[model samples]
Target: MSDCYELFLTCPKSLEGLLVEEATQLGLQEVREQVAVVRGQGDLETAYRLCLWSRLANRVLLVLARFPVQNAEDLYQGVLAVDWHDHLMSSGSLAVEFSGHGSGIDNTHFGALKVKDAVVDKLRTADGVRPSIDKVNPDLRIHLRLEKGEAILSLDLAGHSLHQRGYRLQQGAAPLKENLAAAILIRAGWPRIAAEGGALADPMCGVGTFLVEAAMMAADMAPNLKRERWGFSNWLGHVPALWKKLHEEARARADAGLAKPPLWIRGYEGDPRLIQPGRNNIERAGLGDWVKIYQGELATFEPRPDQNQKGLVVSNPPYGERLGDEASLLYLYQNLGERLRQACLGWEAAVFTGAPELGKRMGIRSHKQYAFWNGALACKLLLLKVLPEQFVTGERRAAGDESRSAPQNEPARLSEGGQMFANRLQKNLKQLGKWARKEGIQCYRLYDADMPEYALAIDLYGDRVHVQEYAPPRSIDPEKAQARLLDALAAIPQALDVDPANVVVKRRERQSGTRQYERQGSEGRFLEVVEGGVKLLVNLTDYLDTGLFLDHRPMRMRIQREAAGKRFLNLFCYTATASVHAAKGGARSTTSVDLSKTYLDWARRNLSLNGFSDKHKLQQGDVMAWLAEDRGEYDMIFIDPPTFSNSKRMEGVFDVQRDQVQLLDLAMARLAPGGVLYFSNNFRKFELDEGLAARYAVTEISAETIDPDFARNTKIHRAWRLATR
Candidate 1:
């Protein structure tokens, strides 16, 4: 056997450079870096040490053979050329993993099959006795990489990925892999901070990955000290004495490190469910004395370490995967920045996030950024020095003014145009506030593009503000439009006397199909607002439209006024706001139908919120299909459909202009005698079918449905009342 063997250390992308440095420091010779891998030459003891010590590597492979191959036969021949008996016994089991493609092997499964056949055939005896395939715990795990028509075969020294540190059996929805977490800590300078006897904290720690990893590093403990098995454990070349020596040395070092006073490492998770699991993980890692976890919210997260000790604050906050999540996440990052400024002065901070744009919203300048891949998603690690100088308090007016160092949560100073916009908002609020207060309305439209340059519709739900910026015209410069939007956003909180963190912003564009009903966020946060004596749920952060339609307030009120002792039917009910109003107004029963199960579930919540679930029915199906099968008659009905929809659940596309007659006729069939059916749509160019007037008594009620709040935009929605002729 060769005294030295070529080794390939595989890691996550962008860690190859760090792995090369680490491998060299671990006594590897001729170390070189490659994409997602580092290559070096090491002896048996060196290989074993690397496996036990590497913090960034995912796998440690010992190259067995390298040969040129051009076809499947060539691949088989190349793998068979290696002496299998020296590595595996005839009674042992083996597994083969093949990566890359070409050499006439397009499918990875087929490539793996060929490699397995070669090993089995070579190990077969005259009596056909050979090794069996055992994927889970193989005596020999072979890896073949076919690249550029050359095949490189190796033995996987680590049975599974090294990232499975064995301490984290339970994790949160999205947990960072231990190796990735280690790399982040290294980049954040956690090692140096720990070496200096500094403390560490993770405010938004999910399952305590960062806390455990930091504790292990600080205590000079080998990450894989607790692992029981490896790919080479059962191999014939395995040296038990050498491995035992390394293990004992590692244990002694860990024991000695633990003998000293442990560094303070704490984690705070907002979810109560994760608290016990995090404590279990820390205990399993034998870091109980060094690390502690508590259930705490981000708003109240304050880490107290020993006096006169400064450290690193590291966290991997959720970046969100849904569409509208960015808007809500903006506030989370803002809060994190605020907390850092308030509590962690003179400390360093590392924030890992998939949304770099949202990270920029933290209002703290990141001195450096490192790019990483969390699985397939590209992410950034923003490193910040939480000093007063890094706080972004807008532009400095003159030097060293006390006002210039204002906190990030403070309302930003307005520009000339912003002041003008703020003045307009004040004027509109003064006029609308009185009317809304007198009408007992807690939610109303405060501004609807009052200034064309701003092009935003600001709605007030209780004390929270929902701002929708109309997509700028193609002729408008995007940069200028963005500046104008900033101006308007800055003006909103100041003018409305609300906190800056209470504002949520989203861009509004012409939606097609069922896009409007699609979930934009997953926060599931709902605000209760009262309108027309009904308590309704409004999720300003999770959808393009809040649950309660501000423009439809008058229509809902009209429905309530006429709903006494009548059966009510609401189609395209959204979150069933209208149905709630009807039920509140003493409707005998209410049935609401929509295509979204999410919305129906939300409707159920809204109905339950108002203590009206018993007589209320929430149906989840295509409204057209539901209406066709529904045989019960309704005394009063209201339908407000989208401008256009191509939902997959529906049979075909629905165009308000083309399908209006058919929709109205189908709905009219369910309308009982003397019943009134109110139909409305927001299609700007919609003209009522003239034939409906002849078929039934149809009266245009568009004028009466427009409330004083939506008076500026009279065409918000056109309404009609129809009955049997």
Candidate 2:
């Protein structure tokens, strides 16, 4: 046996460059970067050192063979060609692991079985015994990977995924993996910089991944110090005395730095629910003295001053997409910007943002940007430099702007010399709207949401943005301007962001109607709109009204094409456009049901506009209530329901999560034998109810059903086509 073996390391994303650096530091050779992984070679000592020191890689594997195979027979011959006696025992258990990317083999398990057969059969012929496959935790684990028509075989040197670092006892919503966290810290320069007293903070510290990692790196701690066991301990080539010495040495090194002056590390989150668990994690890591937890909103925060050097501020704020839509998150971002300017000057900050448009609200240009993954969603970590001049600007404000506009998180402005600046801002926002479309950004707004006085606004919806503004600041009195703003707002509708309803504006505190019509919307007493050769009333006075859903415009166009020849069943059928599509496509009949009589009326108007008045059937009743009555069949159906809602008139509550199974089953019952069910919801976490795979062909047609404009809203709803095989 050789004293050295060529080892290959599989590094996780964001950890690649750091892994190669660490491997070099530990005296390994031939390091290289791959897609989300790093590969290198070393001896047994190198493998052992990596197992203990690799903060970025999940595990290390020993390369066995690199070969080309065209079919299952070739796969068997290749696997059998390996010297099985060198790595596996006749009686030992073994498991075949597999990964395929752009490979001809469609079934991963089939490839794994072929390899397993080759190894076991070869060993059986040589020693009259064969290793059995043990999936849970095999002593001799073999991994097979096929990518781009070539196959790679390797022996797993580390058991488990290596992310179970033994310290994470408590998990919050979407806690990041340990390796990923370590990589991000090192990549952010936490190791080299935190040592120089650049104190760190994660204000919205979700379970303290940043804080914990920063503390560990500050103490020169290894990321995998808490791991209970590793694959090398059981390998026959292991030198027991050497591993023991290394373990003892590592523990001594860690203890040597244990009593050093506590790092000025702190993390704060207002949620009392998170504090106890966060403390639990801190104590678990033996870092209680180094990290502090606080409870409060960022609105009132004061950074600890240090005369030595600027500090570091890093936060992963909730993207508008995290809670729901972009329109709901502008104020949060605005407030974040205000707090940072007011409280965190003289600090380098990294705002790990998934929404670049929202990042613009911070009003500070990012000095650098790093791309990384936060779960499946790709994110941009924006590095911002908080200059010393920021607070100076906030202090020298002029008079007459009693808005006391929270400047820390607001766009910069000058009251006396405002015309040039406002024009620049307006122009930037307009340009941002065009850029957002080209880049296909999701949920980035061009304007701040709480700017109640603006006559027009645009939400860019994400990173692809160019910005501009309109008009100049006039010398009107604050009170008069406020009155005009109120006049502008007093006329819009309740469903402001959705539906084809007109906008209405009404005062919040007025005792009676000053304009005679108290309930009619903002500007629609005599408005008429002609759309698709049909004349319809349009109201832009209220909060919402005056046009169709701009986003769903393409969906309507889709309906007009597909509705002609099929009868339709529209569930939760708001305005019944799908029914219109089915009718226009030459469908025999259309039945639309909804709890809203107003919507049922609107559905009729839509059908009449398309000249399907005779074929259109509108039913104003609770969908849940009417489902059990054995309603008539249709060739096409549309099922769209509110995520969390109740139809009080129907004598029961209808919540999507708790009631999806019954509703989907009901929709299935209403469908014709060969019909397609178009089910959708805006709730991102909605799951298709289980156990109906035997009854119908349920294909998640969400991607296919969504119009071109709504591409990023993949989780908005799931559609299914159902039919017996």
Top candidate, metric lDDT:
1
Best-fitting candidate, scored by TM-score:
1
Query: Candidate 1 overall Cα lDDT vs. reference?
Result: 0.87
Tell me each candidate's TM-score.
0.85, 0.58
Give the range of the ten consecutive residues with the poorest summed lDDT in model 2.
491-500
Residues 1-725, model 1: lDDT tens digits = 89899999999998887788788988899998889999989999999999999888999999999999899999989888999888998878999999999878999999999999999999899998999999988988999999999998999999999999899999999999999999999999999999999999999998899999999999999999999989889988999999999999999999998888999899999899999999999999998898899889988776788775779999899866654344456557767877877677678999999977667656688999999999889999999987767777454334333222334454344668979999999999999999989889899888898788989998999899898889999999987886687667667777989876688888789998877777787778888888887788888888888877788888999999999999999999998999998998899999999988888988998888889888899888887888888899999999999889998888889898998998899899999889999999989999999989999999999999888889999988999999999
- Candidate 2, residues 1-725, lDDT tens digits: the string is 56666677776556577778988887678878887666777877777777777776777887778888777777788889988887777787888888884434678888888889998888785537678888877767788888776778888877776666666788777677777777667656677677776788777886787788788778766666777766655555557787777677777777766678766888878678988888888888888888887876666655563553556777777764321133234445555666666566656787877766566556456777777876677777777776533232335334332222345433332232233334433654456546545644333333332243443333221221211122225664645443333222221111122211221222222122112112233333433333333334323333222223334434444555666667778777766656666676677788888877755666777777667788778888878878878568767777777665444577666777788778878877877776677666656677676776766777765666654334434443565655544
Q: What RMSD value applies to candidate 1?
A: 4.7
Each prediction's total of clashing residue pairs, residues at least 3 apart in sequence or on different chains, is: 1, 64
TM-score between candidate 1 and the true structure: 0.85
